[model samples]
Target: MFVRIVKLSFDPTKIDNFLSNFENQKNSIRNFKGCRLLELYRDKANTNVFFTYSYWDSEQDLENYRNSDLFKGIWANTKIYFNDKPLAWSVDKVVSLL
Candidate 1:
């Protein structure tokens, strides 16, 4: 499994718009081919900061999603609300205590 996390910092005034967009696209994104899981997390102390965590079957699968029209639309819309450049990372598990 491949894990991906994208941390985003949005304009406080646009937070609700971002969340609404995410809510509209969440299901389609989760059901994309090779997608295993998806989640949205917001910082407790700063609601404008958030992270999207997802699991994909492989890097190729993730790439496919990235290249899709759905991704293009959603990402473009999301970017409009950003307060700063987003941070994204893909990682392989080395150890799992759980």
Candidate 2:
């Protein structure tokens, strides 16, 4: 599986908006082709910072989703509330006890 992690920091006043958007779109995102799992996390000391963790069948599956209209639309709606540029990474598991 290919892991995708994205770190996002949003404008303080826009946090609620982002959360609402995520809640509404989470299902569609998780149901996207090749998406194995999806999760969201927030920094305990930094309420505005959030992270999205997901697993895809492969890098191509991730690329396909990134190229889709669904991604474009979602990104467009989501980016406007960002306090800073978002960061993302594609990683692999070296070891996982689970």
Candidate 3:
């Protein structure tokens, strides 16, 4: 599986907007081609920070999503909420502790 992790820091005032957007669009995102799983995480110490963890059948699948109009519209709406540049990583599972 291909794993993608993205760290996002949002302006405190805009957190609600971001969360609302996520809640609204999450189902569509999870149902996208090649998506196996989709999850959202929040930082215990930083209320304005969040992370997205997703699993795909392959890296190409993730890329396909990233290049889609769905992503473009979402990203356009999302980037405006950021307080800092987002960080992302694409990785392979080394082992499953779970």
Q: Rate the local accuracy (lDDT) of all candidates.
A: 0.96, 0.95, 0.97
Rank the models by TM-score, top first.
3, 2, 1
Considering TM-score, which of the candidate structures 1 and 3 is the better prediction for this target? 3
Reference-based TM-score of each model: 0.94, 0.97, 0.97
Clashing pairs in 1: none
Q: Count the backbone clashes (under 3 Å) in each candidate.
A: 0, 0, 0
Off by over 4 Å in 3: none
RMSD in Å for model 2 = 0.7
lDDT, candidate 1, 58-96, per-residue tens: 999999999999999999999999999999999986776
lDDT of 2 at 68: 96
Residue 87 deviation, candidate 3, in Å?
Answer: 0.3
lDDT of 2: 0.95
Q: How far is 16's C-alpha from truth in model 1 (Å)?
A: 0.6
